[model samples]
Target: MMLSAQNLTLARGGVPVIAGLDFTLAAGQALILRGPNGAGKTTLLRTIAGLQAPVSGTISGADDAIAYAGHADGIKAMLSVRENLQFWAQVFGGGAIDAALDAYALHPLADRLAGTLSAGQKRRLGLSRLLVTGCPVWVLDEPTVSLDVDAVAMFAAAVRAHLASGGAALIATHIDLSIDAEVLDIKPFRAKPVHFSGASDEAFL
Candidate 1:
């Protein structure tokens, strides 16, 4: 298994959000998280990415193999597109920056400053980090947030190529992607309600 969660419980701000969740992702497979706002999707992804710890249970097979991408672009504003990619490739131990640029159609914009790109272009740059990481498992949150249809398609193709090379991915998004993946709805694992003792009835008002 590339990633596995067994009876996992996650929390945010000392409040439980996901509980008793169990899932597994294998090589060449993808899992898509589907949920409404405040449904613990980001929380779950963070836990899986090791950015935060789970409240209970255990997660296995998701240690150093994961490459995480969150809502933020995580790119330096003053750097050129190629510079950004090269920097990450070096940090992650020298990956194929040229391939990454080509994958996202960033070759034409290689010399352009990252700060000057549009939101969609910046998002593509952010995603290119995943390629440089060379990690087998991808953990992404809202990866397609600022992308256009063609860009989304490009991302989907990249994901497909990764999976074809025996990699796996875990993604959280509201829109449909172009890959075949198992859908996991987090509603069933919502945390149990907690009761608080408060003197003021106006708190609810």
Candidate 2:
């Protein structure tokens, strides 16, 4: 498997949110996380991406092979689109950024400062970084936010291509990308409220 989480218990702000969560993703496959607002989907993705620690359990096969994109677009506003991609490529030990530029149709804006682009354009640039990461596992959170219809299609196409190239994806998104993927509902894994019996336990809570 490319990524697997067994009996994972995730937390936000030191309080458990989801418990006993288990999932796996192999090469050429994708998994979508489903839950309502404040359902800990972001927390779960964060843990898998190594941004934060899980309260408990094991996440295997996600050490250096994962590329993560969270709610924020991880880009340098002062850098041009091409420059930004080059930086990430160098950081991830990837190759040329030409393919990434073409993937998002950013050839025209390659030299434009990332801060000068519109919301959708910036989002595309951010998504384009995935192509330059050279990682086999992708972990994304609300990847389609601020994207137009065409931009969304572009993102979906990129994901499809990644899977075809023997990569895996774990995404927490509400929009359906029309790709072949399994859905995992986290509502069932909601953490139960812990009753405090003493002052020390209350302090921990």
Candidate 3:
């Protein structure tokens, strides 16, 4: 398995939000996380990406193997598009940026400062970083936030290509990307509130 979670419990702000969650993603597969607002999808992804500790449970196959892209663009404003990709590629050991540029149609904007690009362009640049990471597992949250139809298609193609190359993805998205992926709704795993028997326990709750 590329990633696996057993009896996973996630927390936000020190309060448990999800419990008893179990899922696994093997190479060349994708798992789409579906939930309404305030669901713990983001928290679960973050935990799996090793950004934070889970309230409880064990996650296997995450060490040095996952690339995460959150709501933020995670780019340097002062750098050009090419530079940003180069930096990430180097950080993940080393790789040429040409494939990443071609994958995301970033060649034309290679010389443009990242801060000067439009929202969609910046989002493309941000998403392009994934291709340079060299990791086999991708953890994305709302990856298409600022993308248009064509840009979304580009992102989807990149994901498909990654999968074809034996990579796996765990994503939380609202719209359909037309990829062959399994949907995992997290609402069913919402954590129940802990009961308080004593006045002191009430404070903890």
Candidate 4:
């Protein structure tokens, strides 16, 4: 599979935040997005996730083949670890929570409420959703935001495994993630304001 963006432009409240962005990623490959705050890192990811409509240009190759994990982790506060996994399994298509939990070292907290878990724990839970589906592309924004060193390593390991298994990923992160990936610097095209409505792509480009 291949992911591409052509002269992508985006606006929020009618203000430009990203302009003329373009790139492509191949299966078993990864792209790292780097930029300062307000640089449209998250917006870019959202756009590729098909949750945000660009104001101009086009984002191609984002469809049923992708999985998006936003910065928030998307964990249900009211649910326990297991419950959360069960819910995501239903959405992403059921996968083994026991194995995923074990992989993320969350087995001990499987019965605990997601609201009670630490920030890193929540990120792990949210990322584990990747394993619940067979989607070929992944869009992750600041996936290691609150993770510790070991956890970060674990995260990289899992993502590497995913790529090795023939998947692609677009990651927006500030911390240095020591993984082999094509780097795309978005500072030059940083548009201000960054608008997103989680609507149809037709409304934007």
- Tell me, by lDDT, which candidate is best: 3
Candidate 1 runs further than 4 Å off? 198-205
Per-residue CA lDDT of model 2 for 1-205, tens digit only, reads 9889999999899888999999989999999999999989999998998989998999999989999999899889999999999999999988899999998999999999999999899999999999999999999999999999999999999999999999999999989899999999999999997677798787867
The better-scoring model by lDDT among 1 and 2 is 2
C-alpha lDDT score of every prediction, in listed order = 0.93, 0.94, 0.95, 0.85
Q: Report how far off residue 63 is in candidate 4 (Å).
A: 0.9
Give candidate 2 regions above 4 Å deviation. Answer: 197-205
Output the worst ten-in-a-row residue range by lDDT, candidate 3. Answer: 193-202
- Candidate 1 collision pairs: none
lDDT of 1 by residue, 17-100 (tens): 889999999999999999889989999999998999999989999878999999999999999999999999998897669889
Q: How far off is residue 114 in model 3, in Å?
A: 0.7
User: How many angstroms is residue 11 displaced in model 1 relative to the true structure, after the best TM-score fit?
Assistant: 0.9
Ranking of all candidate structures by their lDDT, best first:
3, 2, 1, 4
Each prediction's RMSD to truth: 2.0, 1.8, 1.8, 6.5
Q: Estimate each model's TM-score.
A: 0.95, 0.95, 0.95, 0.88
How much is the lDDT of residue 143 in candidate 3?
A: 99
Go through the candidates in order and give the clash count of each: 0, 0, 0, 5
Model 2 residue 128 CA deviation in Å: 0.3
Model 4, runs deviating above 4 Å: 192-205
